[model samples]
Target: MQTSPENDLVTIEEAAAMLGTTTVNILMNLKRNLLQGQEIDGHWHVSKASLAAHGGDTKAAVSKPLCQRSTCGSCGQH
Candidate 1:
């Protein structure tokens, strides 16, 4: 796809750093469609535009635990 300097693809790590968050959080955002990105050969590439948009949604880079937000099935305690 066509990419500009401001909209170039960034690795999950780089995206996380840019957002001051974690790679796992970025991956979860990707999975939940909370962020925009694509998987290439099993590696995730994030869109800079998407990252910029998400910036307003967060005040800080704190990561939330799954069970803290809603009923989580992963741990089976919720």
Candidate 2:
């Protein structure tokens, strides 16, 4: 829950708590590019704007992949 004095950016753990989600979920958003992130000193950095835009510290909504013919769990296309 450490804050960066340079930009006042909060850590992922803090963002998760503020957003009511797990850190892993936050990382997922970052990985999928659903949420904007910056790498500082080899670490991922999130901006307050990104968090606020996502509902004041909430998990960013990600598009779930549509079940394709090759991997439709329900239809067993595979």
Candidate 3:
């Protein structure tokens, strides 16, 4: 939530919101090493730099509304 030049720790929910994706997607990316994150207090904290590096602002990739369930199964809602 508090992002500074030294520590830009963002919650998984925050990263998902920024990336226009779901928390599961972010977690999957973390597991696959596509994104960099640190586990703190049993929760994942991602860096703003890492998000930027992984093309976090990929709103274009999210075609459906966040609340809508996808039939394609790409959003992991199926």
TM-scores of all candidate predictions against the true structure: 0.65, 0.61, 0.64
Residue-level lDDT tens digits of model 2 in 22-43: 7776676677565666766766
| lDDT (10s digit) by residue, model 1, range 1-78 | 344334568888887777777798788878877678887777888888777875554415224444455664533566
Worst 10 residues of 2 by lDDT: 60-69
lDDT of each: 0.68, 0.60, 0.69
Task: Tell me which residue pairs clash in candidate 3.
Answer: none
Clashes, model 1 = 0
Number of the top-ranking candidate, with lDDT as the measure: 3
Candidate 2 local accuracy as lDDT? Answer: 0.60
Q: Superposing all C-alpha atoms, what RMSD in Å does each candidate have to the true structure?
A: 5.2, 5.5, 5.7
Question: What value does the lDDT take at residue 1 in candidate 1?
Answer: 38
Mind giving the per-residue lDDT tens digits that candidate 3 earns over 1-78?
Answer: 655333877888988888887898778667756678888877788878777864534654333433264554555767
lDDT agreement of model 3 with the native: 0.69
